[model samples]
Target: MKKTFSREGVDLAYRDVGDGLPVIFQHGLGGDEAQVADVFPDRPQTRRLTLECRGQGVSGYGPVERLSIATFAHDIEALADDLGLGAAVVGGISMGAALALRLAVHRPSRVRALVLARPAWVSEAAPANMKPYAVVGDLLMRHSPEKARRLFDDSTIAAELARLAPDNLSSLQGFFNRPDPVLFGRLLVAIAGDGPGVSEAEIRTIAVPTLVIGHGQDLVHRLADAQVLAGLIPPARLCTITAKSQYRAAYRREFRACLSEFLETLA
Candidate 1:
C-alpha cells in the first residue's frame, strides 16, 4: 500500500508491499515511485519498498541547492530509521544507485546488500559524464522549454552529441517538460556538479553482497563504471544489458528478469 512518511520536514511518498526481507529501492534522477513501477515484480517473500526521493513526485524539493546525492542518501537513512527496517537490501538506478552506494559507505549499518544498477558515479565525481546535464539545465534556464527542446532536437550541438552519446540527448529530452522547470534546472546543476560520491577505499570496504548492472549506448551510466564497481566491490557480480535509452522492450524485460532473479537469491 502507498503511504506517506514525514522526514526532514517533507512528506515523502513510498510503498511497502509483500512479506519477507525488506528491499528498499530508490528511483533514478528523472524518476519517481511511479516511474520505477516496472521494478520489483510481485514477490511473496520480499517486502518491496520504493521511495520517491525528495522533490521527485509528491516529495518536497526543500532547498534547490541541497539536491545532492548526499542529501538523498540522508533521506533514505531517515526513511529506514522511521520504518525501523534495519540493514535492508538497498539498490537503485543511475543517481539512485550512486545514492545507495554512498549510503552503504557512509551508513554501513543501514544496508544489508547493494544492488547498484547503472551507477552514474565512480571513485570520484565524473565531470565529463555530468557535463551534458549541466549544459541542458543552462539551456532550459536561458530559453523557453519549447525552444530548448527544439535546439536539442535540431541543433548541430545536439546532433554531434547524439552521434557520440545518444543517451545524453535522451536525458535532455526527459528533462524538457519537467513538472517544475525551475526546480528541475536547479537540481540538474547541483547533480551535475556533484561527483561520483564515493571513493575506491570506501567502496572497497563494503562486505555486503552487491550486484552491478551496466549497459552500452549509455553515456550517463557508462558500462565502464559498472565493470569497475563489480571489480572493486568484494562480493559484487556484474550483469550487462542493452541501454534503456534504446527503448527496446526486450532490453527492459531482460533487466526486470535479472533484477527478479537477484531478489529471489536474497529470499
Candidate 2:
C-alpha cells in the first residue's frame, strides 16, 4: 500500500510491503518510488519500503534546490523515526546509493546494514561524470523534449554513448518522460552541481555488514566507484551485475542470487 508522510510540510509518498525487519530503499534521481523500485527482492521476514523522494515521485515538489542527496537522507531519517524502524537495513541505487551512504555516515546508530547499489559517487565529486548529464540539462533547458531528443539522438556523442554506455544514454532519455520538464531541468542542474555525499575517509568509518553492487559497461555508475567502496569499507562484499539497459538472463540470476545470499547472511 502507498502511505503518506509530512516531510518539511511537503507530502511524501512511499511503498510499504510485508511486515518484519524494516528494509527501506530509495530510488535514484528522476525516478519515483514505483519506477525505480524493481531492484528489491521480496522477503517474507522483512518489511520492504521504497520512498518517493521530493520532486521525483507521487510526492510534492517543494523547493527545487532542496531536492538533493543530503535532503533525501534527512527524509529517510524522518521516515525511520516515524515508523520506529530503528537500526533498519538501508539500501539504494545511483543517487539513492549516495543518500544511503550519507545516512549511514550521519546517523550511524540507526542503520543495521548497508546496501550500496550502483554507487555513482567516488570522492567528494564526480565532475567527469557530470558532463553528459549537464549537456542533457542544457538541451532540455533551452528546447522542448522533442527537439532535445532529436538533437541527442542524431549527435555523434549519443552514438558513442549508445555503444559504450547504453544505460547512461537511457538515463538521459528518461528525463524526457518526466511530468514537469521545467522542474526536471531545474533538478538536473541542481543534482549536477551537488557534491558527493561524503568523502572516502567518511565512508571508512562505517563498519556495518555491507553489500556493494556495481555493473559492467555503465559510465554513470562506474564499476571503479563500486570497487573503491568495496576496497575501503571493511568486510564489505561486492557483486557485479549487467546494466538494466543491457540485461540478460545470466545477469538477472546473478543479481538476485547475490542479494538473496547477502540478505540471508544478515539473518
Candidate 3:
C-alpha cells in the first residue's frame, strides 16, 4: 500500500510491505516506487520500503530550488525517522545510489547496510559521464519539448551515446517526453551537476556491510564508479551483472540474486 508523510512542507509518498528484515530500496532519477519493484527481490522475509523523493513519483516538489542529492538524502532520513526505524538497509539506483551513499557516510547509525547499484557518482561533482543529461536539460530549458527532442536527437552527444551507450541515449531521449519537461529539466540540471558529496576518505570510514553492483554498457552509471566504491568501503562485496541494455531479464535476475545473497549474509 502507498502511504503519505509530510516533510519540509510537502506530502511525500512511500511504500512499505512484507515483514522481517527492513530494507529501504529507492528508485533512480525519473523513477518511482514501481522502478524499485523491478529489480528488488520480492521475499516474504524482507520488508521493502521505498520513498519517492521530492519532485519524483507521487511526491510533491516543495521547492524545486531545494532539489539536490543532499536534500533527497535528508528526506530519506526523515522517512526513516517517521517510520520509527533506528536502522535499516539503505540502497538505490543511479541518483538513488548517491542518496544511499550519503546516508551511510553522514548518518551511519541509521543505515545498517549499504547497497550501491549502478552508481553514477563516486566523489567529485558533475562527473563527465553525466554531461549528456545536462545537455538534454539545457535544451529542454531553451526550447519546447518537441523542439528540444529534435535538437537532442540531432546533437553530437546523442550520436556518441547512440553508438556507445544506447540505453543511456534512450533515457536522455525520454526527458523530452515527460509530462512536465520543464520541471524535470530543472531537476536534471540540478542533480546531474551534483554528486554524492562524500569523498573517498569519508567513504572509507563506513563500517557497515556494503554491496556494490555494477555492469558494462552504461555511461551515466559507470562500472568504474562502482569499482571505486567497492575498493574504498572495507566490507564491501562487489557483484558484476549483465548490462540491462544487453539483456533485461538477465540484468534484473542478476541484480536480485546479488542482493539476496548479500541480505542472506546479514541474516
**1-267 in candidate 3: lDDT tens per residue?**
899989978999999989889999999888899988999986778899999988788888888889899999988888888788878999999988999999998989989999999999898989998888888888888899999999999999899888888989887887788777788888888988998989999999998999999999988888999999999999998999999889989999999999999998887
Total backbone collisions for each predicted model: 2, 0, 0
lDDT of 2 by residue, 128-211 (tens): 766677677777888898998888789876887899988788878888777777777877777766755677888898899999
Provide TM-scores for the models: 0.92, 0.93, 0.97
Question: To one decimal, what is the Cα RMSD in angstroms of model 2 from the true structure?
Answer: 1.7
Residue 66 error for model 2, in Å? 1.2
Model 1 C-alpha lDDT per residue in residues 22-84, reported as the tens digit of each score: 888888876877756675566677887788877777777887767888888887777778888
Q: What C-alpha RMSD separates each model from the true structure?
A: 2.0, 1.7, 1.0
Pitting candidate 1 against candidate 3, the one with the higher lDDT is 3
What TM-score, to 2 decimals, does candidate 1 have?
Answer: 0.92
TM-score of 3: 0.97
How far out, in Å, is residue 3 in model 3? 1.8
* Candidate No. with top TM-score: 3
